[model samples]
Structure formats: structure tokens, C-alpha cells
Target chain A: MTGLPMVVSAANLPARVRIHEVGARDGLQNEKTTVPTEVKAEFVRRLADAGLTTIEATSFVHPKWVPQLADAEQLFPLIADLRGVHLPVLVPNERGLDRALSLSATRVAVFASATESFAKANLNRTVDEALAMFEPVLARAKAEGVHVRGYLSMCFGDPWEGEVPVPQVVRVCKALLDMGCDELSLGDTIGVATPGHVTALLTALEEAGIPAAAVGVHFHDTYGQALANTYAALEHGVTTIDASAGGLGGCPYAKSATGNLATEDLVWMLQGLGIDTGVDLGRLVATSAWMAGQLGRPSPSRTVRALSHKEQ
Target chain B: MTGLPMVVSAANLPARVRIHEVGARDGLQNEKTTVPTEVKAEFVRRLADAGLTTIEATSFVHPKWVPQLADAEQLFPLIADLRGVHLPVLVPNERGLDRALSLSATRVAVFASATESFAKANLNRTVDEALAMFEPVLARAKAEGVHVRGYLSMCFGDPWEGEVPVPQVVRVCKALLDMGCDELSLGDTIGVATPGHVTALLTALEEAGIPAAAVGVHFHDTYGQALANTYAALEHGVTTIDASAGGLGGCPYAKSATGNLATEDLVWMLQGLGIDTGVDLGRLVATSAWMAGQLGRPSPSRTVRALSHKEQ
Candidate 1:
């Protein structure tokens, strides 16, 4: 029993969704073990083969910041030949942007914090300073004929500051879009968001003249609200969803807790809704199972666990 | 940080949801360990203290079928003193109903399967035969002036049956309502349902004259679809939700997998939506923590894992 969900479509949702697969870049960055360069390249290839079009390949951040993804230069060229697949890499600043450009990367993304506390804590700068820092990177990427994506972290709530105001998040989003970035991915960094808060943020963005087409949602499963929040986002007409394969991101505090929405889980919901994602569920599960075996642990995905059990 | 989700209410949802906590009966019934009668009593008391108005205490089925809760006669008397809380016990047939009525139980429920495969597998009887068997039980309970809840399992998809039809589920629901049931709890026993399927079934139930107020949703989390399906049910105006404390039910094949939706996770979502559930989140977390300790394992709930870590 492959154990797929039965199809039943709802009204007002997009017939097709472009899943922004972030397993290699976002998922493995938080891992305790550093995977080899060959495995990382193979992972990107497998994700492409599974029919994920927009796969975030890796980060060009300083090795000191994310040592796990330090093999970006060695890993990119290995999977760069994947035709018809959009491999988006994260570029922290102009230095990282230069590195991605050197490799002929066509798509790049820069992450910014919505709240001041996270800006200071994560990037050692204020909100404006962080945006100012990404200015040159986005400008250079746009000049180089590369698509740019802006990731707005802490859109829902921040750990240091309890509940984030929707207006405050909207300001950062507008600044990012104005700074030469093409689209924005709203990140619930700590996974503290609920459906209404998700709706509130998306509605606020709409009021600020941002359409749902240019927005993607990145939700963590820290509190098990990711899928429900994703459903709410879809209801608001946001089609691009960011998910990590096998729910790869793990909480540093609790190893058992998942830090990202599992891609397999998302595909199950989409498949059941009769929405086309173009990703083969069987191949995706197999890829996650292989990746989980490499990490010497089980994937934090319920769909993976449930389906993989039947195959065995 | 207690890691509580910030409140942001959704539109057109119920102002308050009735949480039918089923930790003591449905949750513990799956465990291989036999919890003592005193511990079960204390668990019920603690759940009441945590502000759960309706707790499914224990089942009145034969000791041979459910050895874990065979001491229902003893357990019921111990917690009957708790005021202002509704304790619903499951009664399988006439014998089980007789046991429940003799114990002076105010509320009783009968479990049925919506699919023929599950009906044959679980009860060793056809769907019609199973319904006929419950006729006398439901009638006797009604005559005793007790509230009857009809539980229809495999409401969405069954493992052996794949996808259960919306019409098929509605037929059983109508049968239950006609046979003296005050309400129906639709159970997605395999956790394979998606949002559209949930809405479709709810719509069919309404067309069959079963109002949302007369329906509760019981979802498993095997494929991580419970919370998302729950949101869909909420959108369709269903107010009563069934959850297990500490996510007590575990998949026998995969211990890491959760078989029931966690009450803490559901509470976090409800509280974030400003939906009044009369539940104290802090106390509920502590109660689940203590229950997890009694079971000699960490809770499978992400909310339990996230919050309990901060407390420690």
C-alpha cells in the first residue's frame, strides 16, 4: 500500500502550486552532521527528478555562519546541468552574491528579519541596516539577469518579541520588494503562528499592494501548526509554499521536534485536493527515506513514515 | 519562553469549541502498559482541573476486548465525584451498555465503522449486522435517559478500503442519528484525509440533516493531516473536537508516529484564533507532562515537547 490520500478538490484554490523545495539549503543547514558534497549534489538531482521545479540549492553564506553548507562551490556545478529545474541559492551579501554569480547561478535569494531584535541577533544589524546590506546583492543579481527572492523571517511572531505586528512585517516586506527583489517568502521562524494570524499577515500584505502571486509561505512545525497555516495561506490565494524534504530542519533544543513543514506532508494534502504539484509522491518518499538513512535517523515526516512503512 | 501562540481570530468560525478530551479511554486503550486504576482516576481529575469539561473517561467494553480499561466499574466510581464535567464512556453492545447503565454513567457512546472492510475486520460482522447489534444498546441507553454519542470510524479513508465515499459515511451517520444518538463523532482513523475531503464530507452530512452542532471531528495524525483537516472542519462550522492528551495513542509499527491528534497542539491553534475552549494551556501542558512521566516516555506532541523544554 503506497497509502496516498484520496483526491477531493476545494473551491478558489490554484489548480497548480509551485512548491519552493528548500531541503538542501534550509533543512541540512541545521543538521548536526555535515553531509558530503557528492551527497548534497545527489540530493539536488533527486529533488529535481521528483518534479520539484524551484529547489533552493544551497547558501553562499560564510562557512563560519553555516559550516554544514560550506561545500556550496563544490556542490553547485554537480547539479547545475539539471534542465528545466530552477535551483535557487541563498546569498547573504554582495560577497555571497558574487560567489553565486561566479557559478552561473540563475536564481538567488536574500533573507531578512522582520523584527529589530531578530535583525540584531541573527545579522548584528537593525531592520533598515539588514535591508541596506541586501541592496547591493539584489542590485547586482538583477543586473546579472538572475531572479531574486527575499525571505522575510519572523512574519508571524518572534521569540524575543512576543507577537509581531502585521504592519511591522508589511514594512519590511515592502522595503525588500522595493530593494530590487522579485518576491517575498514570509517565514514563521519559530512556528508560533495560527491560521488567523496567517490570514491577518497575508491580508495586510494585500492591503499594502502585495499580491499573493509574489508571496510564499515558510512555516515550521515547532508547534504542529504549519499544515493548518498552509491551508489558511492557500485560502488567501498564495500558491507558492516552502517546505523541506523529510521535514529536514530539526530544533536544536528538542531533537524530536521538527523545525520545517515536511514536503511529503504538503504533497499529500495537495494530491488529495487534486491540485497538481508535478512531484511524484513515490520518488519523493524514496528520496527522503534515503536521506534519512544517510543522516542515521528517521525522517520527521508523518507521510514519509506512514508510506515508507507500507513499502517495507 | 512558554512559546504560546499569539491570538488572531479567523472570521465566521465558532466563538467557542467544545473539546472532547479522550486521553483516558481512546488514548490509553492502545498502550501495552496497564495504567493502575488510581492513576486513571487521577488523570481524569487532573484533566478536569485543566478545564476540560468533557472527558471520555473509559470504555465499558468487556475486559477481554479492552484489558487496559477492564476496571471501568472501579474507575467510574472513583472519579464520579468531579462536578461540572461530562464523562462519556464507550459501550460496544448490549452487554457493554448494561455495564455502563449500571455504573450510573450519564453519557455513553457506541463505535461504528463507515466502511464494510473495517466493519468486517474490527467487528467481524457486516455493516448492517453491526448496526442491528447496536440497535438494542442505543435504545436501552436512551430509555435510561443517558446521552448517546455515535462514533463513525473510517469516515474519510480506511487502510483496507482506501477511500470511504461521502455518501457511505452519511448513511451511517443518518442511521446513528435515527437510532437515538444525540451527536456523531466522525473519525478519520487512518489520518489520510485532506481539507477538501473534510469539507466535502461535512457538506454531505449537512445535506443529510446532521447539523454541524450535532457533529464532532476525531482525527488521527498518522500522515500529519489531522490539524489541517481540523481547520477545514472548523471552516465548515463543526465545533466539537476530539483530542488525546499528550498524544497518547502511538502507531504500533512506528513508535515515532502519532496515531491521535494532540490536545495541546489543538489548544494552541484554538487559543491563537481567540477561540474560547475554557482550557488553561499552562495547566494542560503540566498535566500532559505528568501523564507522560507516568507512561515513562516523552510526549509525542510537538507543543508538549516545545513548551516542556522551556519549563525544564
Candidate 2:
């Protein structure tokens, strides 16, 4: 009662939990004002310092479309200089992949939509057409010995299409995996997907012979189902999860989209489950606090905000 | 394109879900200004109209402790008049029991804590002492044949004493069951409990011969683990859940305690799982909005607050 007290209830936990940090690409992409390249670099450096092994450095999308990540070239080199960090970049098309390759990117991810309508709206192509485009990109990346992560957006529901069929999502996932993508990230672009949807989809995916380890889940907090969906994936043995630091990012297309799953909240959850993500909770909360200060906004991550206030 | 705007991926849901509405008790307990008895009765009536079957009407404690529910006697009669509604009142002592009995209460609940420190601090007595006090109240209530609900506080973790042992929670649960309590509500008291702890505790309780049907979970969203913990509880077949409408209410006894689980958010999760709680989502959101307007503050339920903003 006098000093900081320690109460030990017998401790037991999962051996490992992988957190694929999405702040650089997803977090910054949704910001109203573009962050400077130097700030982005520093954010990546701080993330590394906070023990993030998989830090998404930036995206190679067109500047006209996503101006927030215009300095992807400059930021990649900054993160590439950091030790023991796996810096991955988002590639939208052939041009994006070319830029990523020109930068000697060892790891690059290509994002397309699961539903045809979302593919057209978000990527300006039909689902088959997007897959057709990603085909050559993946083949070239594979030939170059670069790791390719394929992201299937709007897997659960689509803005224009309403409810997307699970089989359609499974079809897209199969095409991406067959195209030699090392991993697939199923996205609930609007954050409307629930645990039941996640459970059903993942079960379907597994039925299609897709290894659980080959999948990651990207969730939005629009409907407040992101964390629940993430836990559903974790329960099914998903090793990779996409979360943004400080709960930054949202889909421009999804009207209710607010923020991504907060890295601090996810870590708080995993740590309680005794899943080691090799990240420090105090340091992670501090980084989120700093970024929240810079953005002049509170983090959507409840644990980070709570801890920061408590510390104050 | 115009017809039913097809949703191809709707969740394959479980048929039925039981909603234990704690709004009247938990929702009003945290407000700085005491709401009038007429307003409380009207609120209970509205919730029942919205199809909340089990509504916690008010607490029968001394007004000196909980000034918010000073008019329990006044509120009970009005609530009891609502047709097809099950009104449950909290009885902290024999005097409280007598008050509830005077109103011909259909259901009465007793409160106790699993942790010794919380039991002593919150109730000003030891765990055994509190149980002994409940014995006479239980005997009188049983003679009258009123349904008794037992609230096992600090079942997961205690603020004063950090991690609660599962056996302690199990023992308290057993004592309540042995005392002829119809249902046992496990109160998180402080919101520091995680899903893992909840799973472990529920598993232990079930292992100790307590049927899942006899158990209910009351969670606080302080640490943002409330919903996840609730889901974990759901997986163990817990039907009845205690939630505050609009995520209102906090324990004044526990410093830094936050509101109970938001009824709106919990309904969203349940409905998404295809579990029918017999409560309308839009109606629940509207009720929270009306309450928030009266309070001159935002609703604590994330789904309610978010959806209300979108509606605007």
C-alpha cells in the first residue's frame, strides 16, 4: 500500500503474438493534413524503439490520390536504415510496384478489394481486373525475390454493394494466395463486420485450404467491432494482425469509418492473454501519447489515453 | 437494384439472447445530480416499452449512501405497474428487504464481494459477515417467495487487492447458490478484468457444478475489455447479461471505475451474431440520445454516440 504494490496471481500466457504495425500507411493516409517526411521517419524510428518488429513504412500509391504519403521514397530509406525492423510498403498497381522495386524494397504489399464493386470504387477496376493487374505485379515481385502481401479490402461488406458474399471473398483470397502472395490481409473496410462474420469467413477460408498463418485481419473501428473481430481471428490462430498506432486511420469510402484498431489497445489485450508481441506497453503508450499530441487529437485507443491521463 | 438491396453475407446467428437490462440501476447511479423519482419511473417504463423484459427498477439502499435512488419506494410502484416487465430491486440489508416487500416486489437482489478487501471497503464488513447478513434477508424473502438475485462483486479483479483468485470467486458463487439465490451476477466491480481471466473464472465456476444458466456477467468498460470479456462469457453459454443503457453508471465506491457495458453496443454485437435480444437497436439509440440530452453530456455507449452523430 505504501509503494507501488505488486500482486501476483499465477502467470501463464501464449508464447507469441505478432502485431503488423500499419501506422505509416493506414494511419497517415487518413490524416487531414499531410505529415512531413521527416516526421514520418521519426515516427517509424520511435516505433522501432518501442520494439515494433513489423513496421509498415509507407505506400507507393499515386501522390494525387493519397497525398499524405507523398514522401514514401524518402521515408522508406529512413526506416531501411533502422536495424531489426521489417519495413513494408503498400503498392496499389504496376506503377506502385515499380516505384517500390526502384527503391530496392525487400517487402511490398498489393491491396485490392474482395468485392467487385469495392474494387471498382476503391481501385477503379473490377475484382477480376484488379486481380489481373496484381497478377503481373506479384509475378515480377516474386521473380525479384521480394515478399508480397496481398490485401483484400471490403471482405465483409461493401459500401456500394451492401453485403458481400463470403464465397466472393474466398474467391479473391484464393486468387491472391495462388498468385504467390506470401500473406493475405482480409479487410473489414467499413468496420461493420462482427465476430460471427469473422468466424464464418475464416472458417470458410480454412476450408478452402488456406493456412491460418497465411492470413492477417485489417479492421476499422467504425462500428466498434474491430477489436472483437481481431480477437476472433486470434482465437483461430492468426499470427499477423494489422493495427495502427494511437488508433489512427479510417477508410475514405466508408462513411462511419473512424479509426483503425489501436496498437496500444491490441497490445493491452494480447499482454493480458500473455501473448508476447515483443513490444513494451509503457513505451507504446508513450509513443501514442506523443503522436496524439502532434495530431492535436485524442487516440481512439482507450488504454493508451487512460494510461496517459493516469500518468499525468 | 432497388428491391431489398441484397446483403449476401449475413451472420448465421444463434436464435435467442437474454438481455438483463440494468439501465435503471446502473445507468443513473453515476450522475452528479440526482434524477427525480418520476423521471426514473418514466425511464423504466420507456425501457420496458422498448421490449426490455428484465429491468432493474431501483436500489433499496439507504438514501445517505446512494442519494440517486432515494425514492426507491416511489419508483418501485410505478415500475411494478408496467405490464409484462420484470422489476428487480437491490436490497442491501433487512430494512431494504422490508421496503421492497412493502411494495410487493417481484424480484430482489443481494450484493456481496468475492475479495475480502473490496467486501470490507465497499460494504464495511468481511465477506462472511456480509453473507451472514444476507442469510436472514434470504430467509424472509424465501418465505415470501420473492426471486433473489445475488451480485458477486470483484469476481474478476479487485481495485484494493489486485488479482482475484478463481477459487475465491467460485466459493462466493457457491455460497450464493446454496443460499437459494435464483441467479448469480458476477460484477467486475473494477474494469481491470481481461477475457482470459473471465474465461478462466467461468470455466472454474462451471467445473465447480454451477450451471451456465444460473450465471450472469456484469462488466465495466473502464479498461475497454468489457465487450471482449462479455463475448468470452457468451462462449461459455451465459444467457443473461447486465448492461447499462448508453453505457451509463460507475461505482462511486471504486475510484476510477467507469460505466457498465453499453446496452446499445451489446445489442449490436448480439444482433450481429443473429441472437435476438427483443430490443430494437434504433429505439435503444434514441433512448440514450434522449437521456444524454437531459444530462447535458454525450452518451457513453460508443455505438449509440457514433450512430446518433451519423443520424444527424
- In model 1, pairs of residues that clash are none
Across B259-295, the per-residue lDDT of candidate 1 in tens digits comes to 7899999999999999999999888989988988888
Model 2 lDDT, full chain set? 0.80
- Candidate 1, residue A128: Cα displacement in angstroms equals 0.4
Q: What is the lDDT of every predicted structure here?
A: 0.91, 0.80
Pick out the ten consecutive residues of candidate 2 chain A with the lowest summed lDDT: A1-10
TM-score of B chain for each model? 0.97, 0.93
Off by over 4 Å in 2: A1-14, A250-257, B1-15, B250-257
Candidate 1: where are CA atoms >4 Å away? Answer: A251-258, B251-258
lDDT of 2 by residue, A222-305 (tens): 656777777777877787898999877743223344678888777767777777789987888788778867776666666665
lDDT of 2 at B65: 90
